[model samples]
Target chain A: MKTVKAFAPATVANVSCGFDILGFAIEGMGDIVQLNEKESPGLEVSSISGDDGKLPLDAAKNTCAVAIQAMVEDLGINPGISIQLEKGLPLGSGMGSSAASAVAALIAANEFLSSPYEKKDLLPFAIAAEKIACGAGHADNVAPSLLGGFVLIRDYHPLDVIKLNVPQDLYCTLLHPHFELKTADSRSVLREAIPLKHATIQSGNVAGLIAGLYEEDYELISRSLRDVIAEPYRAVLIPGFYEVREAVKGAGALGMGISGSGPTLFCLSKGKEKAIQIAKAAEEVYQSIGLGVDVYFSAINTDGGYVLTE
Target chain B: MKTVKAFAPATVANVSCGFDILGFAIEGMGDIVQLNEKESPGLEVSSISGDDGKLPLDAAKNTCAVAIQAMVEDLGINPGISIQLEKGLPLGSGMGSSAASAVAALIAANEFLSSPYEKKDLLPFAIAAEKIACGAGHADNVAPSLLGGFVLIRDYHPLDVIKLNVPQDLYCTLLHPHFELKTADSRSVLREAIPLKHATIQSGNVAGLIAGLYEEDYELISRSLRDVIAEPYRAVLIPGFYEVREAVKGAGALGMGISGSGPTLFCLSKGKEKAIQIAKAAEEVYQSIGLGVDVYFSAINTDGGYVLTE
Candidate 1:
């Protein structure tokens, strides 16, 4: 087999209205994983650029390593492997940075050894790795990063992950502030349960969001892309949250919300120009709070993860 | 303006898994409303057919009358209106018979005055008229029957409604048994609250349903369509429910669930062949139970409400 590599983009786990179930991919905020077969019986991983600290050399403790090991167990293939991860997406920022690394590593590893397993087949292993990090397996991030576009994880007798087609001219403007809200931390802060009214409103928004994506009506899409269940509770943790959302709204953005948990605030705009405008306006709000911010202008990633180059 | 008439299809409120929020239109199951300028400030309603003695001909009590009344109140227009309604859909059969009349009347009245209000502007009155019948201001049926296609009604604020494009081969087989499940009665039977785990599963299916619509994968669509929230509680009212669903599934139906409330069972199939197979199989079940059956072999309705032979 020829040498192989792959890239899975970082995904915003909850696109406002869809909490724990809905997610979309951002183009540039991603990690690239490269894999090669060797004459050994185990796995190895190394962190390249984009990550601040050295990734664990041991394959068992790291997210990427755990995912690969789980896949090996599933396929019962004892092929020796080595992987290099180009971690571009930020970690611990609700934007599913850990999931990107884990998914990319697994996709690369499985593909390099010949895809003996389907994408959905590998969800449990990937989710298990996520559980180790976030204390639970929420497929909101992993599914999108692994499969691409907007993914729906239907947890049932047999779990199903489905992807939605995003319309054209829709762009995501992402702003990560100088803070990190770990998934575990965010999950802990939330109430164990919520009011019935909140659930009803949230469910209504979920229906509307799915419909908006199908219809591609920007105005309605914006209006429907609301997170009444989680955002109101989670937003309180993010500084300058309302101002940033207001700025994005005033800049002609369709919608704005905290990406995943918090610290990173993102908005959807009509085009690149509007995305940039929204980003600039959002940055000013972030700066007002004396915080450092990183901005990304991206579109809905239709193609999520695959062998980009070999 | 030339004399004009409009027909809107009766929709299925609570499209199986999506109760009180999601709905879709059936092409031939609705009421036709016609309005023309008359000399006096009079609004007359004449029910032509298919009421089963359930319709009120009174201008104040008729569904069409109530909708037109609300429209006139809001518009403050004195265009003397002559309204004619031909109710094609069965009354109080889980199908949104009342909403069809409501939306159709409002649309005819709007067009009578040469489009006094835009379609988006007509939602409030549509819901209000629907309220006159069901004693609730819900848009699950009105939005789709008025607009068309799969719809999500997220928020009345700024009115977030999105129309999703259903797949080309998305065939639906509906089985209507001779029974009545009033919206109020079915709603009353449901628990005011639901189990959290059960809610999570349903949310996953909703996510999967939306994702399945986008990706155009029948397998994913079917898998993502499990209903854990309401179907279990509501499916009891329909006789031969389990047998119909099983027979339909045995006939290679992709997804199956209750159409609206009771008696009518709808299943999504891969194509016309499977739809026919499921329909035939389902009809046999209903016949064996000695019940009246009306079956529709249709697609996801794209054109909701429009003028009929104006």
Candidate 2:
């Protein structure tokens, strides 16, 4: 029998200007999944911890089990794996919690099988899990959690994903308030159509952001980190969103935006000291509103998921 | 009196994925404007060539004269400049004819003042001329024509133009059918609003194209050079548009799109040989329809507008 423990970093999707196509992995926070081989030819959920009984116990509904099942079918191997998910990220807080779990479980299962699949090959499994959790199989979150650094989903029909260059000095500060905003609820607020003028401006910003990342131009990044499409509608869902953003930016953040959907916000800064300052500024905003928040600050995770123990 | 002859290369705006923000300069054809410093204090349009006498003769109405007037005011000097306009590019042919004239005149005027304004500073003068020519002060064409290479107009309110790195081996093929399409007419066909899904896809492609240019990955560039915003509505304005695009792509062009608005199409290829092949393929499509076209092939113009003689 073989057992392995794996960890995958959480991801921040959209990154402001890149609505549904861009994301990046961050360190210091993630979900951990442990897998053990069994003689039975079926996947099972052995145990779940840290979720306060909020997650489903049924293997068919759990993100980790669903992802492992897909991986099993892709490998053409009998399912004899049991998954144990440890929830480190707050569920449904726009921190890519489900994606982290799926990635961690897939990495653990691959490790049990002598690592037959490369990291990129595990994307389909993570996407499957995403569909089960969020009802949409967007790769912006999963791709970064798998490949690390900034990942751009160029197209979805054939699943074209590219890993982008990450500036070494760039750091991320994530502020997760203790609240839940369902992905579907947040998405429902967006308009089905947008003005052509806004679309053009959004595209310009997206292009500028990509160019900024490659050139390491922080000023350009700051200018481009604006979400004209979704922020206007979704910002109301998060409490004190504008105040928090203004505070973080005033503390010298490059830019701040709602991560994924709502309740959680991410700020990008130049270095650790700036990231710490931004986190403090954001924390004060939530504190004044009588809401508790959890903060994570770290450099970009260059390695997405890794085996912790075997 | 200081007399100067200046040449500014034509430009291709939008560049498929970049709707209103991306453009690049091309070689082999341009407008050459000769500026003669007059002893008398006043700007005058001495003579215009190759324009079929269609352009305005009044110094206030001509694109060249309008640009030079702006330059004269910016230099805080009395207007003692007389301009001779040479129209190498077709008028209203979607080949940046008006922008080239404005850029050439500005360069000539700058040379007459011992080049007080750098190339980037001349963008405002060119934009002013564009407003008179097309009723919009867009810098997509003028920025590239002034600075050369690929230029991204990130913002317009306070005009932020960034010059991106051009792949050394990249070549452009410009096919101009002997017809005219007004920029305003082409723009009128586009809807005021677009589906959100299409906008997201368009932004993704824009980001991918910028990343591809920096990475020098031809395959990525090919995959990303798609225009979902304007091409669908405006393609009907160009006869045999689909056939020409198909033939050019089949001839191993990275991609093809309407140059600025309509009537002129640009194809990007890896090398000169491939560009020539793409040009031949595009020509055959027009020949089948009994239409004649002028083809221009050259590497991207690294030097946008320059002083030939002073």
The numbered model that scores best in DockQ is 2
lDDT of 2 by residue, A159-237 (tens): 9999888888899999999888888899999999999999999999999999999999989888999999999899999
What stretches of model 2 exceed 4 Å from their correct place?
A: none
| Model 2 lDDT per residue over B1-310, tens place | 6789999999999999999999999986899999887889988999999999999989999999999889888877886788899899888988789999999999888888887987799999999999999999999999999999999999998888989988999999999999778888999999999999999999999999999999999899999999999999999989899999999999999999999997899999999999999999989999999989999998999879998853
| CAPRI docking class of candidate 1 | acceptable
Q: What DockQ, on C-alphas, does every prediction get?
A: 0.39, 0.92
lDDT of 1 at B38: 68
Candidate 2 similarity to native, TM-score: 0.99
Docking class for candidate 2: high
lDDT of 1 by residue, A53-136 (tens): 745656777788788888888777777777777888777877888888888887887787778878667677788788766667
Worst 10 residues of 2 chain A by lDDT: A301-310
